[model samples]
Target chain A: MATTTTPAATPGRTKGTGKPAGPPGRRPRRSLLPYLLLAPAVVLELAIHVIPMLVGAWMSLLELTQFHIRDWSGAPFVGLDNYRVVLDVNSAAGAELLRSFRVTVIYTVLSVGLSWVLGTTAAVLLQRPFRGRAVLRALFLTPYALPVYTAVITWTFLFQRDTGLVNHVLVDQLNLLDDRPFWLIGDNSFVALLIVSIWRTWPFAFLCIMAGLQNIPDELYEAAAMDGAGFWRRLRAVTLPMLRPVNLVLLLVLFLWTFNDFNTPYVLFGGSAPAEADLISLHIYRSSFQTWDFGTGSAMSVALLLFLLLVTAGYLLLTNRRRNDA
Target chain B: MRETATERWTRRIVLTLLAGFVLVPLYVMVSSAIKPLQDVQAAFTWWPRRPTLQAFVDMWSTVPLGRYLINSLLVASVAAIFSVAVAIFAAYAVSRYRFRGRQVFSVTVLSTQMFPGILFLLPLFLIYVNLGNATGIALYASRTGLIITYLTFSLPFSIWMLVGYFDSIPRGLDEAAQVDGAGPLRTLFQVVLPAAVPGVVAVTVYAFMTAWGEVLFASVLTNENSRTLAVGLQGYSTQFNVYWNQVMAASLVVSVPVVAGFLALQRYFVAGLTAGAVK
Candidate 1:
């Protein structure tokens, strides 16, 4: 919008200056300035993201390994063999990858679902002012504001088998369980990862939902009340519908971030996560870094990227269509 | 709407429960940071037997905590400054001008946010190595390499959010500066940027925090000399024992600046983040 009006004004104002204005001397310079301004971002993005991605795709087809890392050009180009090895269900790598994928999917769903619910509940409850609301709001956002490593490291300390407060509460104080459970390892690792993920993420959801609620008119709730609607009915009709746009973007972002989360698992489990909680990001990290198989790791990374891209595209399309239908 | 006594009780109970959930780990971090090392490693206690700041004092000697802190500070700050400076110009361009390929540029930058960091990690690592080999400059385990890698993390969101922020600023102010014979750069820096201080602060803090907490790249990219706190802190736990108390102490020290900065500027940061979506 600024573009349409500004360019027209520029030419007209320059014409009134009485210069020979068949493409003013400043026109080319002006046109080039935007590109000049954009140059740093473009170059950084290319060097950091775009070129790396293209190179990753290329590396997926090569037999790149630690042995060949210094001189990757010498690594033989293996046509689709890395993909075949990683995708074959019968193979160990493929089986592990599939299992990791399943774990990640379930983890993402639960983390995103629970986080959204908690955030929305807190936001709606806090929407109308009450005593100590500001303190509670700030307190709730503390986890999100804290560094991920610090928060997860704290969680790790709390989840320690012998000395963790979680077990101390559940086993020692509350006497809920007969045995002290290990949180950062084995079957319980999934639950631990999920709890930390939800804890770290829900505050973000609350922030977004709270921001979204500010835009919703109080008149809607009043109208619903006048229609003899109860709180639940008002929430269902007025609150949820009005929060759709926020929910759409928030949910998608949460889904992607949660799915691709490397920090929570990495810090909580310390690089090598248990099979139960091996998020795909960390799994790929181990595959590449641990096994020193850059080619297969790059293949898995490319595959994961494609899957995420597909999900994002589909999510946008579905959400856009729903908005149109509504 | 007015709430009944029953509803009020439920709200209070839920609020307390959620607050406890949020505060417990933080409580643990603070409590553990002061507890004696043996008290932390031996048993989990709600109250510290002998609470002391000895762990805080010991944390520095236990590892290269000071070096890690300095490295993290330097890397995160430099990356944040560069990302913000670059984003300001790019955001201004996208916000104020019509250019060929502007839409493609915007979309590409935004879409980069969706791709997982792992997708770029391996290749970026390789590129650093290869480029180092070719040019005789060490990027594989260098601070400059880490800073470059970190730009990708913050630059996209910085540009996107700043674009939204700049769009909200009225174009007339810049136009008035233009009519006053101020060039575009001058109009941007002297005229437009003054009004967008809050937005700039928000972006800078976001970028700094992102670089500060990042683990994935920091893990692989940095070695001993250039190790950041994110990876360096893990050194406290050796094969034989874990210095839990010292780790907690160090975590708190590193977390203070970021958490305080975020909470202080929470309003502006939230406004900048949700501006594009909520509108």
Candidate 2:
């Protein structure tokens, strides 16, 4: 991985043509061209992404109420009051935010863990040659290929109380339940959201793991098998070790995407999410847009962003340390 | 390795069951889209009893679905093309040239991906509102505003993907081009870029799909006239009378281009995704 990335990271470092030096005046101009070429993208990224982040942090500090939303410059400077409100566990709002944060954490852990495990299992199953593998691969990838709204809206229909397929299958066909279950409205909403989340995301994990599987040399597996290693033993000794780096990257990416995911819950639940399934993204969105509290919303988001940054840094450190130790 | 009969049968059965699990929701969606409203609500069937395009036809008249689709297409295509075009030049510079602050610039590009996009919503909304107020340019509820926002998210990933792609091309190609007296830009376009066509298409597909399915930004940034398909889909159920058939029909329509696009370019998409992860 390091070798593959170094070319882009420090290209032209080792390539000294050993040709006669260019004219003294021409070197500087030639060197500046790369910067010129990179300017538009750099500038746009800064203006569109970076500057707004700074502004968001600034907005979090102010008392930007709905009355002042139209012209925000005049909004009062609250100096962490918004953060205080969100963090004040004694307050009803703060207590709710804390509960939502806990909910978000649980959702992220479950969604990421299930997707990765299922994905890795599927990838291992299909790693070797098989008949009709091509068709099976395409079939497995269908969920990931479809747009999120399409998939989740279909889930919304399937989770309908009376007419949905899930209930029909469980109640009418399988006789598992006597009455229709309200999937979208209660504690079951969390279960419903998890099913949709895992359904949409597992294929992605499968794809990444499959790609990672390609890099494992076949010789190691052959040697292990010769040493009297069976399927589980060979997998544990050879495959998992080789897949560590890929899994690290995959896990972090999956966690981040799932944690920041806004579309799935929004589409499945519509405008306001049920309390049981209130992931932080929708919670913050409602606080800001639905209730017209941009300051509190920004503050909550800033907190979330800071939390993610800390988590990512810690994850990278732990993974890198483990890799080095191994 | 050779497999026994039971092992082969087991693999087949497990894979087939997984495939069925994957396809069931999609089967439900397509079937619901064509089924009559009564049939959809009253009882579930494997296939539509009276299959019709009436729902698809009615979706348009019901809520300006055509306009939403056209708006989504226009925004997605423009953003994809423009973002990829800009990213190619930046990618080339990073991949080929050694410049001051190169490491910092590259890391900055990667770091942008880590920030949650919702963090930008409030500030960007404020910026657009203020800019429109000052200049009388209507960005508050316009496609242009949405396009610009989408570009930010799309550009970073596109640049990163293209950099990996450009790096894979042998340096000898550029060196040979230079020997023949081709300028750096000319060599980039004439020699290196032609080889990176797969990467370009991969980036284009990625950017297009990102913009196509975007709901959070589109929901906030667009209104009636400027609404994209994503937000328009929301309107179908939010109104007093819920139209399940039309909603499903509209979603199917909105998803077709992206699904087809991903299937056609599945190879590139997988390559692009793995390139970033493994490297």
Per prediction, the TM-score for chain B is 0.97, 0.95
Best TM-score among the predictions, by candidate number: 1
Q: Which candidate is the best by DockQ?
A: 1
Model 2, span A1-326: residue lDDT tens: 11221123332322233334343213334466789789989898888888988999999998888898887889999998999999999998799889988888999999999999888878888989777887777777778878788889889989988778999899988999998989999899999999999999999898888888887899998899889887778889999988888889889989999998888999999877898889888888888887777888899999999999999999999988987898
Compute each candidate's TM-score over C-alphas.
Answer: 0.94, 0.94
- DockQ of prediction 2: 0.48
lDDT of each: 0.89, 0.84
Q: Give lDDT tens digits, candidate 2, residues B123-218.
A: 888888889999988777999998888877788889988987888888877766554444567568877899899989989988998898888888
Q: What stretches of model 1 exceed 4 Å from their correct place?
A: A1-30
Measured with C-alpha atoms, the lDDT of residue A172 in candidate 2 is 87
Taking the candidates in order, what DockQ does each have?
0.54, 0.48
